[model samples]
Target: MTLLSTLNDDMKQAMKAKEKDVLQVIRMIKASLQNEQIKLGRELTEEEDLTILAREMKQRRDSLAEFEKAHRDDLVEKVKIEIAIVERYLPAQLTEDEIRQIVLQAIEQTNATSSQSFGPVMGLVMPKVKGKADGALVNAVVKELLNNL
Candidate 1:
């Protein structure tokens, strides 16, 4: 099933189960998906849906960080639960080693010998890593590789 269909089914199950937290999270996801469809004036492809899910996951991670810094353990726990719910729909994420391997390959393919070539390598890398890797991780890897060059 498409992500949308699976989400819809989960929404129904949440409603029946009277799980407020899960239902609320699912509603926010549905709203985000709907907003994207409205913004583009067309249905979303699976890749587009994955992009939206990733964006949502990123937002939750940012919020979690802020909550932690503020010493709001209660809020931090809540956000962690939300993050878990959001992750259910996303594809399996790449391990650090896997991402580094891909970055090395991209660098090789793009002949990225220095910082100047980082952009070119990233352009070739992001699409291949999308949904499976985090941007911050990739950026850090690329920076480290470029710095050593």
Candidate 2:
């Protein structure tokens, strides 16, 4: 099923079950999707949908990191739960090793021999790993592998 339809079903279930956290996150996700569609004035493709979902995941991860740094346990706990909910929708993430292999192939394709080639290597890697891996993690991997070259 499409993300929206799945969210709608989950929303109904959450309401019936009175699961406040799930309901709130589902509402937020639906709103984000609807807002994007309204902003673009077109139906979003599946890839665009995944892009939005990935952005949501990234935003939560950033918030989680900040919360942890500030030692805000209360907020940290809440954000972690939200992150878990977001994870339910995302595709299975690429392992570090899987990501490493992809980065190696990208570096090979671009003949990237130094950190200066980071941009070209990343350009080649992101599409192959899009929605299946975190951009920040991919960026770090590219940087590390290029630095070793």
Candidate 3:
């Protein structure tokens, strides 16, 4: 099933179950997707859907970090839950080791040996790991591997 259909079904279930948190998160995601669809003036492709979902995940993570720094335990916990819910829609995430391997291959493919080549290496790796891994994590791995070269 497409992401929208899955979200709709899950939303209905959440409503019947009276799951306030889940329902809220699902609505937020649906709103984001619908807004993007309207802006693009067409149905979103699977990749576009994934991209929007990933963006949602990133925004939540950023909020989580800010909440942590502000010492707001209540907001921190709620954002964490939201992050978990957002994760449910994303592809299975890559392990650090798996991401390392992927980055290594990308470096090899691009013949990138230093931080100077960071752009090319990142360009090569991001598409391969897109929506499957966090961009920040992949970037850190790339930097560590390349700097050691």
Candidate 4:
């Protein structure tokens, strides 16, 4: 099944099981996906759905950080739960070493010798890495690699 379908199924199961936290998280994800579909005015392809899922995951991460800084452990725990739920739909994350290797490959492929070439390198790299790698992590790797070149 597609990731969206899997999410729908899990949502139904959660509802049936009366799992409040899981149900709420799934509902939020569904709303996000639906909003994207409406905005695009077409059915979402699997890749588009994955992109939406990734975006939702990013929001949860941001919320988690804010809750932590605010010293709201209860909210932090809730966001963590939501984050876990959202992550179930994401592609497997790339490790730091793997991301470093990919960044190096992108630089080589683009013949990027300076920070001036960062955009082109990123354009070529982001599509390949999106959903699997964190954008900030990838940016850091690119900066480090380009700076030393």
Q: Estimate each model's TM-score.
A: 0.96, 0.97, 0.97, 0.95
Tens digits of lDDT, candidate 2, 1-149: 88999999999999999999999999999999999999999888888888999999999999999999999999999999998998898889999999999999999999988999988998999988888999999999999999999
Q: What are the runs in model 2 whose C-alpha is more than 4 Å off?
A: none
Clashing residue pairs for model 2:
none
Error of 2 at 58 (Å): 1.1
- Stretches of candidate 1 off by over 4 Å are none
Could you tell me how far off, in angstroms, the CA of residue 31 lies in candidate 2 after the best superposition? 0.7
lDDT value, candidate 2, whole model: 0.93
Predicted candidate 3 versus true structure: per-residue lDDT over 1-149, tens digit per residue: 88999999999999999999999999999999999999999999999999999999999999989999999999999999998898999999999999999999988998987889999999999988889998999989999999999
Query: What TM-score does prediction 2 earn?
Result: 0.97
Candidate 2 lDDT score at position 62: 96
lDDT of 3 at 137: 97
lDDT of 4: 0.87
- The lDDT for every candidate, in the order shown, is 0.91, 0.93, 0.93, 0.87
Of candidates 4 and 2, the better by TM-score: 2
